[model samples]
Target: MSGKGVLVYGEALVDIVPATEGRRAEAVLGGSGYNTALTLARCGAKVAYNASLSRDTMGKRFRVRMAEEGIDQRFVSDCDAQTPSATVESIDHDGAASYRFRLSGTAFDVAPPEPADLSDFAHLHVTSFGATLGVSGQAALALMRRAREVGLSVSYDLNIRLPVLPPPDQARSAIEERVPFCDLVKLSYDDAVAVDTGSGQDYERWFAGGLPLVLSTSGDHGADLYLASGGMISAFVPASEVVDTIGAGDSFMGAFLASLWQNGGLGPLLRDLPEEISASAMDFACRVAAETCGERGCKPPRLKPKPPYD
Candidate 1:
C-alpha cells in the first residue's frame, strides 16, 4: 500500500462555476472522481486517473491539471467526443454549489482496462456519474468486479444526482448489486437520500452482510464511521473560515482513503486498526475538507499531516 498506488476510475470533466461576484463561468477540473485523484496525487499518493479525455480545450486543461498535480495519465482513454462540462451555480453565500451536468456529448465513455493495465495498483476507488448513466455504467460495474476479483481494496462513493441519472429504484438497484464487492462505501447524507443509496438500511444490510466499512458524512456536523465488526467512530470536524464548499466531500474521501491506506491497507484497517488511528484518519480528512471549503473550488490545502486526532 505504501509503494504501489491508488487507481481512481471514473469521470474527468470541467466544472464551470459562475464567478461568485461576476457573470462569467470559471472552469475548474470537475467531477468527484477527478477531484479525488487530484487530491490523492497532491497528498503524494502514487495515483493514476482512469477516464476518457477529449482532445478539446477543456480536456487539455484537465490533462495539464493532472500533470501539474502529479497524477499519472497512463490509463486515460481517448474519445472523439467533446470533454464533459458541468455547470454549477452557487445557491447561497456559503459558496455551496448546485451542479447540473451537460454530459451527452462529453467523453466519459470509459471501458474497463486490460488486467495488466491495473496490475500496478494496490487499491482502487470509483465514483460519480460513471457509476450511473448507461454510457459508462456497465463498464464501471465491470471494473469494480474485476478489481475485487483481483483482491484490491475497492472503494465506492455514491455521489449520485437525480438530474443526470435514471429513476431512484433503478439507480439504487444498480449500486446495491455492487455492494458485496466493495470494501468501503462512502456517502454524504444527501447522497444517501438520492437514488441508489437506499437511505440507511442499505448500509445496514451491507454491513450485516459483511461489508467492511460504511462512512456517511454531513457537512459541518462531522462524519460517522460504521464498522462491520460492530462499533462506530464519530469523526469530529475542525472549524475553518467558510468560503465555498465546492468539492469538500471529494477532498474528504481522498484524505480518508489516503490515511487509511497509510496506516494499514484497507483489509488491515478494517479488521485491526485501533480506534485512535481510525479517528485520526477521519480528522485528517475533515481538515483537508475544511481547507477546501475555505477556497472557492476543490482546493485541498497542500496535503500534510496535522497533529493526530485526539
Candidate 2:
C-alpha cells in the first residue's frame, strides 16, 4: 500500500449533539473527509488522509481515531487554530441531522498547502462544500489539479451545507471551478437542486461536458448513476434501521471506491468502466450507506476477509 490506494483531503471536525431524550450531551468524530477516510480504511482500502489538525483536545481526538482506524497520516499537519465543530441543532423523525458550525479561524480554514508529490495514489477524494470556500477552496483546487497532473482518478462530493458556506452564487462559482478536474462527482439530489447553476440537475449535460460519472443519491428514495458512455442505472437502498444519517454519503463513496479498487477499475479503467463493475459498485455502496445509517455517527462496517459483495 506504499505507493497505491486513495488520498483524501478536506476537513476533520467534531459534532456536538445536545442532550435529547435520555441521551447526554456528547461529541462525536465527523467531517466529510474524516468519515470517508475512516470508511475507506475499514473497507480494506489503504487510505492517506491530508487534513490540518489543530493541537487542541478535539484535534487530538481526531488523531487518535485515525490511528485506531489504521489510516495513513503522513500529510496530516497541525495548525495554531482550534479544531472546528458543528453543533447538532435537531434530528427530524427521518433521522436527518441538521447542524450549526463554529469554523471561523479553525484549523481547516487556513491557507492551502504547497504542492507535493501525488504520484503515489491511485485516486483522490475531496468532500464538504465548506471545503470549497475561502482558503479551503484553494487547497481543494490545488490538490485536484495536482492529482490530475499525476493521472490519479479524482472524485468530489458536493456535500453542501448552506449553514457553513457563502451565498449560493458564490458557492456555485467555487464548486463549478473544481468540477472540471473530477472524473466523478457524488451529490445528493438536494445538493443538485441547491447548487444548480441551471445545469446541476441536468445529468446528461454534465456528461456531455466531460464528467464521466455523476451519482445522485436520495435517502430511501434511492440513488441514480449516470454514465458518460450511456444510460442511467437506479439502485434501491437496502433496508436498515435508521439511527442517523451523519455519514451515509461518505460511507457510500468509500464502499463504491473500495469495490472499484477490488475489481481493478479504480484508475484509468474508471473512464470506460464496465457496466458490471459499475452496477456492482453501486449496490455495494448502497449497502454500506444503509449500514452507516443504522449507526450512531459515521461508524462504517468492516469489509475485510469477507465483503458484502462476496
Candidate 3:
C-alpha cells in the first residue's frame, strides 16, 4: 500500500472481438484501466489496478490475467452483479475498430470506494469512461479528491466514447468537469479537435487552467507534448505494421507514466521541460505505442531502458 507507484482506477471488462478469417469471436479481458495497467506492468512498473468486477467467470479470468501480468490485484473489488462486456466489430483495412457495449448494472456502477484503503498510492490514473459510469463518477471523483488532498499526482485520459454518454455536449461537459482535477492529461488528435477547437493548436488554450502537462497523439504522425511554461515538443515515429489500433493510446499513456516514475522529476518536467528532453520522452512513448499497434490487442512490447536525459 505504501509503494512509490501508480494506481489505475476504472472498469475491468471483457472485449468480445471477431476472429480472423471468420465469424468466430474471441473474448479478451480488456478495459481502459486494465490495458494501461497491463502495459505498465509489462514495462516493469509497480502498478496496482483498482476496479470493480463480478463474482463471475469473466471476472475470474480478468483477475488471472492481472496476476499473470504481475500487476497488483489487491484493489479489485468483487460484487454480486455481472461485469460489463463490449462486442467489438471486425476491423477494417485501416486497422480501425468499432464496438457495442452490453453494459447495464455492471459491478462498477455499484461499487463504492474506501478512502482509508487507497491513500498510500503515489499516483492515480483515471479514464474518462470510468468517470462517466453510473454513480461510479461520484465514487471516482471522491477518490480523486481524497488522493489529491493527500498529495498524490493525478493523470486523466480523455478516452472519449460518444455512445456511452447521453449526448456529445454532455460528454464534453463531463470530461471538462474532471480536467482541473488532473495534473497530467492525455488526448488523441481527434479527441482534442472535437473537444476544443477543430485545430490541435488550440488544445493548450482549451484546458489552460487545468492541465499542466498535455499529450496529444496523432495516429501514424506521432505525438506532441505541451508544457505549462510555453514549451512544446513533438515526435514522429511511424508504425511498422499496424495490426490493430484498439489500445495504442493507452500504451502511450502507460509509457509516459513509466517515464515520469523512473525520472522522478514529473513535477518540474510538467511545468518547465526543455524541448529536447520532452521530445525524447515523446519519442520513447511513440515507440511503445507503435509496438503495441503491431500486436493484435493492447499488449505493449517490452521497452528497453532509456537514457536518463536526451
Best model per lDDT = 2
Write candidate 1's Cα lDDT for 35-108 as tens digits: 89988877667888878888888888888888888898887867678887778755576556787888886687
- Error (Å) of candidate 2 at residue 41 is 0.4
In candidate 2, what residue range of length 10 has the lowest lDDT sum? 301-310
Q: Write the per-residue lDDT of candidate 2 for residues 258-283, one digit (tens) a residue.
A: 87777777777777778888888888
lDDT of 2 at 305: 22
Best of the two (1, 2) by lDDT: 2
Candidate 1 clashes: the total is 1
Provide the RMSD of all predictions against the true structure, rounded to 1 decimal: 2.2, 2.2, 2.7
Which residue runs of candidate 3 sit more than 4 Å off their true CA positions?
A: 1-3, 22-24, 115-119, 193-207, 267-277
Poorly placed runs, candidate 1 (over 4 Å)? 22-24, 110-117, 196-198, 267-273, 306-310
Q: Estimate each model's TM-score.
A: 0.92, 0.94, 0.90
Better of 2 and 3 by TM-score: 2
What does the lDDT read for residue 165 in candidate 2? 79
